[model samples]
Target: MTRAPNEDAIWVALVDDYDVVVKGVATMLDPYRDRVLVAELDTDRPVKDDVDIALYDSFAQPESDQEQIKVLLANPRARKVVVYTWNFHPELVEAARALGTHGYLSKALPARDLVAALEAVHAGEIVFSDPPSRMRTPTSQDWPGRQEGLTDREAEILALITQGKNNADICEVTYLAPNTVKSYVRNLYRKIEVDSRTQAVVWGVRHGFLPDHHRIDHWRGGP
Candidate 1:
């Protein structure tokens, strides 16, 4: 589908069996009229054009699992999808990211907040979890995102590690297991050639990956 650059168009599509959710959003965006064009999709029909953002309500009868989500994400313009569901599973969040979704806003957040989320994703920044996440810090030697080329999830875990949390803590916050966090750390260390946390911190700081304003002490379980 072709999108015209003439208008600051935010083509939004709603994939949900529940009509109320779609209607509610339509009513909410009613005031913002021409700024956003909302498309309410019934499962039977094909998504008309390449929309800028798509909202999927996973709890609906037809359900939208990873596989279904994978299909929806095939559209190049549907990069900034905001998913809503009854469950707040971190694994689901990981899955959505893997499927190319830029944000995951819960249905529980106020209706108005949903607009803010759509606005945020449309602005080109990612919103994985609501209420900005507080992750544990990893060492300087193994900074986040610049590993010997770790996967996106690995980079995410590394960023959490640098926030100063222990493996168990990371698991609790991310809904991952302590052992899994350890495994990621060990693998990342090996890939990045970092021996210890101290070395990771030193190297990270040197490379500017560890911002000066952010200290690692708090991430290590300090208050």
Candidate 2:
């Protein structure tokens, strides 16, 4: 299904601090200069500004993984982000879905596959499945396994934080002391790679399954 390169160029932001990866990808994609714009970004890049697509390494911890994803998805210009990695984790895919990722593929995949994945996502299909590898199937049964790898419980606590819950309400609901909850929320923001409830809400809506300010989950009679 290799069609003519759609008339518009796809702007891609390569968000990695490593020089070799950035340089290698850039060199590999040199032929498509007119079609691809590659910029190696760290935290310093204004993530919310502009981008059309992204190729990132999300084969890591949920905390770090989501952090990198937020940087790309937050961009108004970015419509899709394809995570390139050697090892694909099931939980990472789940988080990416919540975060609105376009798709992800293996770094070991052929170069043609990578380009095809990029084009596929850019063309409006969000490919979320990872082929069988060392990773286990992404069943709901794997939920506990997914949550277990967190560097801290604070981030897990943040997952339960609804938009309307205040510090006092959270203390009562979570059964944590008020000061502890506040500290946890602060740390959670740093952990899940978001700043405010709004960002977290957006993050949840895109990659995780959660209700928005509209409280649609409540309306659905969900617990």
Candidate 3:
């Protein structure tokens, strides 16, 4: 049965760089409007609205050094920050926790579950299902580029490139200078034997790094 929204709804802000994705998520939460009062809709900007939680969706975005999370956490308007993305890699989860994310949700979650997670997080609970702890096992499966001779950071950058993020986008998320990003791109091309972004993306998709997983197939344990 559908539970009625709480009388004291949690104020939320959906933050992302894509308007369509942000607005789409907002629409999905519309049914639970009574439970989650979406107070702000922003695209990669400092959240100005006072909200209980800031949901940052890494939709079509590259994996970075959790810089954006820091930005969100620094903003006084948002009391807590949650990452809603398809990057279920174990390293990303550790990064999120290290950055102090209240919750880390996979994009595959249904709206109902997402709502419940938001409610729990607002109620002072940490929620996470992606990257099950076991996946963190010291094995090759944990690293996407282990066989391909790419460092974790390189693989991360390559993953972003596969998502069609340009140098500026990667730099912004990874907190790297433009020139440094260019260097990474050059190194990735050399390591992956791809001369251009197109070739690199092709390699990435074939290597299971581009299309983020929907479920935690490599998880080890824990919530």
Candidate 4:
């Protein structure tokens, strides 16, 4: 059951380069607003609020290897930086942990479980989700190309392609094996009906595959 709103609700800021991806996470946590208030949604910008948690959504963004997490961790306004991602390779998790990330959550979690995890992290506990099952259950999360029938992973690959990343760059950023990256590229190409990398990049550009370069401070009422 939905609880009454608490004045001390865990203030959360959803951070990602894609507005749709961040909004999707906000919508997933909407039913639990009383427990977790999504105060800000930042796209390609540093968070400006004094929030309890900065949930960094890794949809199409660089993973543990990149500097985004470090940037979030450096923000004094954000009390804690947690990575909300689909990739859970041990190396990536260790990298994030080494970078002082407070929590590492999975995209496979249901809304309620996700809220609980955030609460745990707020209470000064380091949290990490179990390795997701190979056959994953569908959740109410969103990605850039979902409307066009691309899974979140496929959408991520396409987004990187749109950013002018070659297969090698994608593999490095995503931590996927060379073969796995090639396979994802192949599948996404078929889904988008493109015959070449150039065609795929063109389709991605036309279909909102690029990162958003704005911020939405919901409480203040505009970007």
Index of the highest-TM-score prediction: 4
For candidate 2, the per-residue lDDT at 104 reads: 71
Which runs of model 1 end up more than 4 angstroms from their true locations?
A: 1-6, 42-45, 61-64, 77-79, 131-223
The reply for model 4, stretches above 4 Å from the true place, is 1-5, 42-48, 63-66, 135-138, 213-223
lDDT tens digits, residues 1-223, model 4? Answer: 1223586799888877687787788889999998999865534444445788988887776643347777777767778989988888788888889999989988888889989999999999999888788624236767788988888888889999998999999988877899999999889888888999999989988888987645422222211
Name the best candidate (by lDDT).
4
Of the candidates numbered 2 and 4, which has the greater TM-score value? 4
Whole-model Cα lDDT per candidate?
A: 0.56, 0.53, 0.68, 0.79
Instruction: Summarize candidate 3's per-residue lDDT along 130-192 as a digit string, tens digits.
Output: 644322211211246657777545766887887888888887666668987888789878988
Question: Residue 185 in candidate 1 has what lDDT?
Answer: 81
Could you tell me the C-alpha RMSD of candidate 3 in Å? 12.2
TM-score attained by model 1: 0.49
Residue range with the least summed lDDT across 10 consecutive positions in model 2: 214-223
* Residue-wise C-alpha lDDT for candidate 2, range 105-223, written one tens digit per residue: 76555444566677778888987646545433212111111343332234335445534456676565444578877887776567557788877656544543232222111111211
Model 3: lowest-lDDT 10 consecutive positions: 214-223
